[model samples]
Each structure stands twice: as structure tokens, then as C-alpha cells.
Target: MTQWTAEQPIVSIRDVHKSYGQVEVLRGISMDIMKGEVICIIGPSGSGKSTLIRCINALNDIQAGSIQVEGQEVHDAKLDKLALRRKVGMVFQQYNLFPHKTALQNVMMAPIKVLRENPAEVEARARALLKKVRLEGKENHYPGELSGGQQQRVAIARSLAMRPDVMLFDEVTAALDPETVKEVLVTIKDLAADGMTCILVTHEMGFAREVADHIYFTDRGVIVEHGAPAEFFTNAQDPRTRAFLDQVL
Candidate 1:
């Protein structure tokens, strides 16, 4: 893993709360992500793990509290959501690729359109990113032509093309076949090793144990337990965390 110099947090969540109509999904949640940190969020379905990350990028609006990325308030009316999104890349479980576009085109599209970079340069960077993910030869393949793992890697490459300071992954390997999960996990592990600030919501305890600097266990819209991976996975002090781990792991 790349050695990260200890410094100020790159992302901060302060007393954040979210609700969909009358249904409260997040309740006064707070967390901090330091530069180059890999934080994993694990919880039962509907515990607000996904909602929290979505709110960080303004994909989901919060009813109360604050989320800040790189010291800029994410929910402020004057804040530019587009600019914030460009800095905080996200990868979803469903390899949300443009089926009509080839892998390289998909990676190049955002940097060319959003950042307004040179097309040739963006294409070259996209190709290099694909190669980094071990998808070099598959660049010309459309999403339909690739397997689930390949498409997910392309989605990751697409996100990385934005050169985000922080990456949010929401159950990225949940939909993959068991045999295919390792490849995607390997790519993510590489990112963690490279010291990319990452926040992942996943059920893969082994991956969390192996790569995450900190693991949070959430329940009923609250972060019930959080600690280093070694402590959280093996010696979690909370019963709720242990129960959840037993059921899932």
C-alpha cells in the first residue's frame, strides 16, 4: 500500500440525516475520511449505508445535517453539484455502462464532455486506465460483449477517468458471479494499495478485512460499531455487529 502522510480529512460527514418522505434512512450519522484512506461500510440491507454515500455526492438529498467533500459543503444551495460530482467518483453494483458505447468510449466520454479535455488525450488516458484494470484488449468491446466482471472493470475505469479525489463504491461486486467476484475485488484491492481515498459499501467481509483501513457496521440507520478491520471483524464489541457478521459471513 502507498504510504499516506497523516493529514486533514478529505471528506467529512457531520450529524447527517436523510429521509425519504416519512421513512428516515440515516440518523445523525458522522464520519471522516482522511486523505488516501480506504473505509468500508457494512450493514444489513436498508441500514443507510448506500444512502449515506449517495448523499456525499448529492445523488440523494438529505433532510438535515451536513456533508462536505474536500472542505466544500455538498448540500449548500450555492454549491455546484456538477463540480462536486466530478471530484467524487462513484461506482454502483450494477455496472451502469452505456451499452451502446465501447469500453474505451465509455471511459473517454465524461472527461471529454464534462472536463472538456482534448478527445485524443482523454482517449489515451482511458486506454491506459483500461490497461491498469487488465482490460486493455477489451477496449473496443461494447458492454453487451463483455462479461459482468469486465463491464464492472470498465465502469471503474470510467470513474477513474474523472481523476476523482475520492471514490464511492456501492456494493460493486454484489451482482457478480462468485467466480467473477475475485477479479473485480483484485482491481479494487489494487486501488486500495495505491492509496486512493475510497469508501465502499459491500457485503464482502473478506475483502473488507483484507483491504479496508476501517470498517463500520451499521444497523437501523445508525453506525453501531466502527474500528480497525482486525478489531471490527474478529473482536467487534457490539452484539448487533457480531450478529450481523454471523448472518452474513
Candidate 2:
């Protein structure tokens, strides 16, 4: 346990664990995500990569340990979870857009309903976010009308509308066609370039190598190895990490 200092991480997970009934899913996981750091979590399916990030955002409750976003304990009963959610935005593999709502409306829904922010101000920010993801004119289009790439970009914009301090992306490109994957990746890379604190669970090894400030290789619900891009991909310390990289890279 460490006290907050000048360099304290924005998101901190300490000995976190999760399970479904008796089957343990996360095994004593711990990590620190510094401000402006892009952390890429890579592993075989079911290795708890997505679960860890979900826990950080409190999308799923953990049985033990603690997670803190901006120093507020995520598991605290008295803490405002809705306010915490504004600080940590998440995008899933599925776009999860409201089919009834257009892109601009979808992005504006959260801030207006949850934060009670002014509709005019939220609309302005929503438009800018859509433009940032290269979907300026598509704001009027519904999710069903856009391509897979376009929809995912809208999802990104919807998340950014909250002005989150940390963004958790859970296998965002898995469902997209090969042709459309790059466009989504490029949109994410642009965010990384802008110094967003992002944690992405991705199978796109090359993109992870290019954009990640730190990389973690997990297995069986535990982090087996972690390091900078070059150090991790080139010289993974754990056998499981090496095996995973050998297969992916």
C-alpha cells in the first residue's frame, strides 16, 4: 500500500478478485494506471483482461480488494457511482448504441440525463467529439445506418462525451470486419496521441505495440508479465507471456 504522491496513479487496483459463484475469474490482480498512460492488456480469451477493466469502472462488483479512480474508492457504498462513471468511461466490443437514437442524440444522452448538464452545452461537446472521431457529418445518422467502423467511432464519441479521466476499451475491434478494423484502430490511436489514459483489451498486437505506454500479458486471471512495449514484446520475462507472444506476434 502506498500513499498518494505527486505521481500517484489515477486508477489503482489492489489485490482485486472476482468470481461467479465458486469459479474464480480474477485472482489477486493489482495494477496502477498513471495519468496519460495507455495500458494494453493482451492475453488468451478468458484471461480476465476485460474483467479487470470492468472492475475498474465498477461495471461488475468484486468479492474482495479495492479499486480507486481519482482516489475515490470504487467499491464504497456511500460514494456516488454515477459521478464515478463520469470520470471513467467504457466502450465495449459491441457498440451498444441505442438504435432509436441518432449518433448525436446517443452521445448527448448520458451527460444530459446523468449529469443534468445543459442540453445546449452537451450538444456542442457531443458534436465536437463526433468530429474528433472523424464523424462530423454522420452525427445525424442512426447506428443502423452507419458502417461498423462508423458505429464504433460513434461509440468512442459517446464515451468521450463524459470527459472521462480514464477510458476502458474491451476488445473494441473483435466484431468488426478486417477492412473496417484499421479505421477504428486509427481513431483509438488518435486518442492515445492526445494523451488519454486508456486501457484497452485488444487482440490487435501490432496496434498495441504502436500505441501502448505499458503492456500486460495475463493468464488464468493473473498478470504474468508487464513492461514497456519494446521490453515486453522483445523480452517477456514469463514463459506464458513468451508463448502468448509467439502465437500472436
Candidate 3:
């Protein structure tokens, strides 16, 4: 594990550009995310919020500029993409759990299979992670037997099994029932509270305002404004940002 200073950014994205067949999704996006910081990205649909995080993890390659995680260039051809993924764990909207596996098995699979870690150690960690997400006794339950929130929590535990340096959440609550969303959000909030560096792309305005260290508003593939929650929510400088907050908040 690499030690990072408070002054240094664990994740640095500089003027990144992404497009699909001339439909540009990200344009000159830049941000510096420090270790232990919780950054919430909010914007209208098609504003590139999800695309930007995807580019950070190299799931979508960029057309120009750079993204670095802990001084390692994310898009370097020689860079091991799997290694990068191990350091950056991502949870998406859908809980992509293996239907055949139990919650504990779902969490244990990646570390044991992908990292070739010892099964015993992986299982132990998986149990602890499940408990951390408040799914203490669901270890034996399959995905189909669990609620949406419970399955999502299992997905979070699965990501944590990799022991990532940073966690990326891309609308992890979007698919859940309104009642289930709070449980999922609470799991994420606990991760943030535990000093995990996180970058979240979400539409949950209130949750974002409460948990984020910095709030970034992106529009038309560009960051229109960003600031601490107190300032960003109360005194947005950009017209676009103000309009966005008015609608959401």
C-alpha cells in the first residue's frame, strides 16, 4: 500500500476528453481528488458524470489528456489494467451479483479467483465486510433471496474485498426502491466515514450534500462549478449550477 500526503491528490484527472463516434461525452474535465476525500458529482442526464468516472477507471479510454491514480498513469499501455482495477473499486447502479452464489461467496470470489489469494483469508475478510455493510447474517443467502438493498450492500462488500485505494460509485442507488435506497446510501456513507477516498456520480442531491467533501456540478461535458457543500449548495456562482440546484435541491 502506498502512503499519500494530505496535500497530494490520490486521483488526478487533467483535461480528459472522451467521445463515441464523434459524440463527445467528456470535454476537458479536470479534478484533483485527495486521499480520504469524498467527491460527489451531480449533473443533469447526459452531462458526462458517469462517463467521467468510467474514464478514470479506464473502462472507457480517453481521447486526450490524462488520469492518474496515486501517480500511476491510468491509460498507459504498459500499465496493468487489472492492477489498476484492484486499486480502484467501482459499484454500479445494478447489483451485479452472481445469482448462483451466496452473499459470502459473491464477496469472496474476486480476491480468491482474480488475485489468487488464499481462500481462507478471503472468506474471513468477506464475512467482516458483509457485517460492515450491515448484512451480518445474510452470508448464506443468494442474490435472489436478498432484497435490492441487501444485494447492493453485498456488491459493495465484493468491491471492498479487493482492498481498493479508492472507491467509485456510479449511481449505486438509482435502481433500488425508494425505501431501499437509504440502506444502500448508509452503507456508502459508512465507507466515507471510515476515511475511504471516494468519487461518486449520483442524483441523490440530499445525500450528496450531506456526505461529500466537495460537490462538483457538471453540465454539457464540463464542470460548471464546484465547492464545499456549504458554499456549493447555498451560493452557486454559475447560472447553470444555480439552475441545477434549484431543480434538484
For lDDT, the strongest prediction is: 3
Q: Residue 181 lDDT in model 3?
A: 97
lDDT of 2: 0.91
RMSD of 1: 3.4
Worst 10 residues of 3 by lDDT: 1-10
Sequence-dependent TM-score of model 2? 0.96
lDDT of 3 at 12: 93
Could you estimate the TM-score for every candidate?
A: 0.96, 0.96, 0.96
* Candidate achieving higher lDDT, 2 or 3: 3
Clashing pairs in 1: none
In candidate 3, position 32 carries an lDDT of 98
Show the lowest summed lDDT stretch of 10 residues, model 1: 1-10
Residue-level lDDT tens digits of model 2 in 50-164: 8889888888999999998888899888879888988899999998999999999999999999889999999999999999999989989999999998999999999999999
lDDT ranking, high to low: 3, 1, 2
Candidate 1 lDDT over residue span 1-249, tens digit each: 233334757898999988888988999999999988999999999999999999999989888898888888899999897889888999999999999999999999999998999998998899999999999899899999999999999999999999999999999999999999999999999998898999999999999999999988888789999999988888989889989988988
lDDT of 1: 0.92
